[model samples]
Every structure is written in structure tokens, then in C-alpha cells.
Target: MKKEIAAVVFFLKRLIKKAEKLEAEKVDLFVERLTVALQEKFRGHWYTDNPSKGQAFRCIRVNRFHKEDAELLRACVESGVQYTDLGLPKELTLWVDPGQVCCRYGERNLAFTVASFSSDDSDDKEDVTKKVTSAVERVTSDYHSGSSSDEDNGCREPRYITGFSHRPPYQQSLLCHRMAGHVPVFCGDRGDSRRHVVLAQ
Candidate 1:
């Protein structure tokens, strides 16, 4: 009876050690993939935030599109890892700062700083996953439709983006045309100027 109990304890210890090892490897792989995505797609930097905090690895910051989701999501997918694994919150909310996007995973929550939008309540995993999927689909569609192969291969000109979401259809169409590199002459100005647009990706 004593020998059997000792053997059981030893086996359990070995299994626990194996599980820890696997978890460590998974964390390492996640970090590596994230780093690559930041460097290649966003031309950004990735580094550890602090070693003392639990699962607090790194946050991404880019010079351009720091407040935009399209480039960030593209980088996430290009990393070839799941968003959850990358420590994205189930109820993802982006808080904005000047010229930088930030995120960190904690034991209790996932924090992101990118835009003004936010949510206190966490959503179900399935719901969050679906939202991310749909958003990625939209981004992919926009990428393929807006830019051609030549433009994609060549040096991308800086884009002037206006807050066209609230604008009327004609204005939105005009901006879209501009986005596609067609400089259509507008004979009359309705009090809108180039100062209103922000230079972005």
C-alpha cells in the first residue's frame, strides 16, 4: 500500500512538470509569432513590458495607423496565430494615445490602448471570435478592392483619410476615388479643405 502511494505521487509530479513545459513552449511560440507580425506588417517594435507581471509580454506601437484596426488585424492574422493566443480580450476595446497602439494581457483582463471605444463587460469567447472574423473579412475585402498589383508592389503613397463615415454618399464616393489614386477635380468647395484630412497609410 505504501509503495503504491509513493509511485502514484511520483507519476503525478512528472505529469505536472510535463504540462508546465508545454505551456512555456506555447508562450514562447506566441511571442515569436507576434514579434514577426509587428516587424513585417506594421514595421513596428515588440519588446517585453515587464518580467514580474504574469503573462505581461509586449505591446505593439507603430508610427502610422496607430489608431486604426485594419493594419493591426492584418498583422495579427499574418502572424499565423489565433487572436486569443495573442492575448486579445474577449471584449476587445481599443483606447487611443498619441501615435501608438498598445495592449497587454493580465491574469484578470486584457488591456488595449488604441482608440476611444471601450467595453467593461467581457463577451463570450464565441461572440468575440465571430466579431474578429467578420472584421478581418471586411479588411481583406477592402485591401483587394482598393489597391491594384502595381500599387501594392510599388512604394505606397501616403493616404489622406477623412472622417467619411459620417459624411454623405457623394462625399464618401469622392474620398474613395481619392483613396484609389484618382485626383478628381472639384470645381466648388463646400467649406471642406485639405486641413481636415489626416495623412495616414
Candidate 2:
């Protein structure tokens, strides 16, 4: 588990560093590729694709280690934004250590991920699987429509996120859509039944 976590850390560190050195449009493209790599890692695959050349992050900051889902929530609050989770995210891959997602405004793209923020972090295996499934559904829906979020106002803080059950008594079965306020960007898997939207909070 430690080795797996370390590998993800290395990938993200490299991604942020490279992304910071590129131009705006190129940065967006790199972010897209980075999102792809993250989804692969979240889905339990070995993702080694580097989006750009190895450098240092200037504007984008990928939190080296997201220990738990709650920290994601904290990051969102710190950023002064609201984010949502996918209603179904498990069908892709379950990440032991969370990763970052990219949110695009008119010209800027901020990267982040969601995790458990509530104190009731009672995420069993079944619960987490449901969350993953929920995420997939939300992103698919957004993709069919579009990411209509107003990008200019969202803060620059590195966003972190997590999915939870709004239906408290039934936490194990269903996931809730809490990030309804922001624009959702969908990233897909090349060959799998899993996909999700990256919302900026």
C-alpha cells in the first residue's frame, strides 16, 4: 500500500511541475491528460503517462499526500468554493490515496479532487464503491450536456473532494450530489465502463 501511494505521489508531483511551465492552452491540454492519468490511478491501474516535461509547479499545486477524504473537504472550504461528488464513482477504480482533477475556466484550469469531509467518515468498501459509481454518473451527464460553470470567480486553492451519502440513514447504498453549484468537467476512460466529472468548487 505504501509503495502504491508513493508512486501516485511521484506522478502528481511531476504533473504539477510540468503543467506550471507551459502556456495557458498547453496547460489546459496537459491538465486533461493529467486528469486521464488520475482516473487511471483512481481506477486501480498503473498510470505512468506524463502530460508534459518534468519541471516545477508555479501556479498549480498538487497536494503531495491526501491522507483522507475529509482533507479534501477542508481544501474546498479553504478555497471558498463549493464542489460536488459523482453519484456513482466505483465502477472505474477505487483509489486508496486520492488524486487531483482539473477545472477549466475561460483560460485558467485549476486542479483538485474530492474525499470524505464529514466527521462521519464511515466509508466501508461497499460505501466507497457506491460513491465511485455515483461520480461516473454525474460526469457522464455533464459530458452529454456541458460544463456551464462560471470560471472567473472560483478561487485558486488546490481543490480536494470526496463523495458522501446525503441520505444519512442509508449511507451504504446511495451517494449524494453535493457539488451542484460549480461547473462539472467530464474525463473519460479510453477502454472501460467508468467515467466522472471534475467540478470546481
Candidate 3:
């Protein structure tokens, strides 16, 4: 089993190179990081039909972890240390999205939501233009009518996110993304259903 996991890791490293070849910029790998250089490796799959890397790593750790690791996990979540707040290099930031760590496990019975989103380079300028225009119009109306708190607090800038996970229907790690350079969001949200499969021999 360990050998099989190792092979999957090795295969993902090669797939990362393939993703790089498809784009010009050096990509961010959100997988396992080296303790030496703080470099992360790709730990996911290549989507042949779509632009994505699927997060489906089998967790041997679940079956063979130190007994105290659970306590550590619980503590980390309680500390409110958001991994997203760790101002990493943008390249590295886009690699993996870890489950929001929490001690209480969430259920997997939620309705699965397959989100249809655009890649950063997707030809969706019209949509963006419409959104921005609508936002401006709303703000303008509110300001004219004196009905918004923004007049006192100032308007908060619209936060623009390039890519977001189309979370799996069942709260599992079965979800994937369509990122530039074909990078995948290789981790589960909330660590719901913990399962992985070998997509290749």
C-alpha cells in the first residue's frame, strides 16, 4: 500500500511537469512540501477531458497515524490559524486548498453542488463587464438615495477571485477545478468523506 501511494506521488510529480509544459509561468504545487526548501509537490491527477486536477489521495495516515495526531489536528483547528492567511507566493497559493480544519467532523449528506465557473483565461469578458457595471450601478443608486452604509464606512472594494472549487455534491473531495495551466485544487473541503482511488495502474 505504501508502495502504491509512493507511485501515485511520483506520477503526480511527472504530471506537474506536464502541466507546466502547457503554460509559460512556473506553476504552484500545493501538494506535499519539502522540509528543506519549503517547496510543494503536486499530489493529484490530470483530467484528460477537462481542465482540472482531482484531489483523491488515499490517506494511509488515517489508518496508520500516531494516536496523538488527532489531538494536534484538533488543536490546530481550534487555534483559528487559517492556512489561507499565510501569505504564500501566488504560484504556491493556488496549488491546494485544505479542508478548513475543525475538530467536529461534518456530515457528507449535503446536496452536491457542481459549480460552472470560468478559468482565469476563459473568454468571459462580457460576464465580467456586466458584473462590474451592475456593481457600479448599484453603488451609484445607493449613494444617490442615501440608503447605504458605504457613505459612512466607505465602499468596500469588490473582491475578485480567479478560480473557486466546484464543491462536490456530497461534501467529498470528489470536486475539482478548471485552473489556468491545468492545475487542480487538490484537497478536500472539511475532510468530509475520506476516500481515494487509483485512476491508473
Candidate 4:
């Protein structure tokens, strides 16, 4: 019984020593990784598409207007409008219209006279034109591409060729611009439903 106890004690000492060493190594690794992360953050070179990079593509802004306000605008703009929750700040929803004129980015801004609009007419061609034009302008400006055409079929073509284009730079610029108040399509996941949730968190 004495020998058995001695043996057990000896084995336990060795195990504890190994565990301590492992703990020390883990701490060292953590410190090293944290240092690298801090440097990257300060340098603004930390973004990556890697699932582990921890980024998001959504921009949410809170407006003073409430849902009722939005609804009022909807009624004035068009009937049969659709509004959906954006999971954003207190009072905003996505608005859509079927008959609205969709403006492409970088298109010429159009001016409309209020005299052309009547209370009975629900078509807000002027508002649609402005919203689309603004969205397109913001996208183009962030991407640094040339002006978009106003031709009937004018569409902003992707500047980069597939398989050879370096997309990180362009994507980063767009991301930053979106963060800086550009109204862009929210494409980021809200840290759920995928292994890549880190990118949106």
C-alpha cells in the first residue's frame, strides 16, 4: 500500500508540472496574438474576408421619425407600399414600390415640379428618381469608378474582371463608406446562422 501511494504521488507531481507548463505556454500565445491584433487595429490593416476576421456589412441609422411618420410618407408617395422591419434603430423600415422609377447610381439628377403632382396621384416619380440617384452616386463614389451613364439602358458595370481582380481594397473602401453614412444594401449577417459570423460581428 505504501509503494502504491508513493507511485501515485509521483505521477500526480509530474502531471501538475506538465499542466503548469502548458498553462504558461497558452498565456504566452495569447499575449502574442493580442499584440498582433492591437497593431493591426491601429494601422487600419486588420480587415479580411476570412471567417475569423470579425466584420459586418450592415449599417443601421436611427431617424427621429417613427413608423407612423414613415407610413404617412408612404401614403403620400404611393399606395400599396410595402414596409418591413430592418432590425435597426428605433424607427425605420425598408420601403418598396412596384411602379416607382428605379434610378441607377451615377445617373443624372432629375428635377420635378410639384405642379405636375396631384393629391389623387400616388406616383412619386420625383422621390423615386432622387432616392435611386443618391444610392447610385454613393456607391460609385465609394468605388472610385467613372461616372455612370443616363442612357435608357445605362447600368454601372463592375470595374474588376473576375478571377483576376483584387477585391479586398474595393470592398474595404465600400465598407468604410457604408459605415460613414452611405445608404447601401445590408449584406452582413448579424452574427448568427453561419461559421463566418465573425465577419459580421
TM-score of each: 0.26, 0.22, 0.19, 0.17
How high a TM-score does candidate 1 get? 0.26
Winner on TM-score (1 vs 2): 1
As a TM-score, model 2 comes out at 0.22
Using lDDT, rank the candidates from best to worst.
1, 2, 4, 3
Model 2, span 125-190: residue lDDT tens: 454344434443443454334333332345654343333222343442222233334444433332
Error of 2 at 76 (Å): 17
**Which regions of candidate 2 are displaced past 4 Å?**
21-94, 97-169, 172-174, 182-201
If both were scored by TM-score, which would come out higher, candidate 1 or candidate 4?
A: 1
For model 1, name the residue pairs that clash. Answer: 94-115, 95-114, 95-115, 96-114, 96-115
Model 4 C-alpha lDDT per residue in residues 1-201, reported as the tens digit of each score: 122122222222222233343344433343344333333332432222331232221111123323333322332234222222211122222211112111222212332211122224474656534444444343334324322232233434322212212345467445434432223433333355321111111
**Residues 82-107, candidate 3, lDDT per residue (tens digit)?**
33232121111011113110111111
The residue ranges of model 4 lying beyond 4 angstroms of the native Cα positions read 1-121, 145-196, 199-201
> What overall lDDT, based on C-alpha atoms, would model 2 receive against the true structure?
0.33
The top-ranked prediction according to lDDT is: 1
In terms of lDDT, the poorest run of 10 residues in model 1 is 1-10
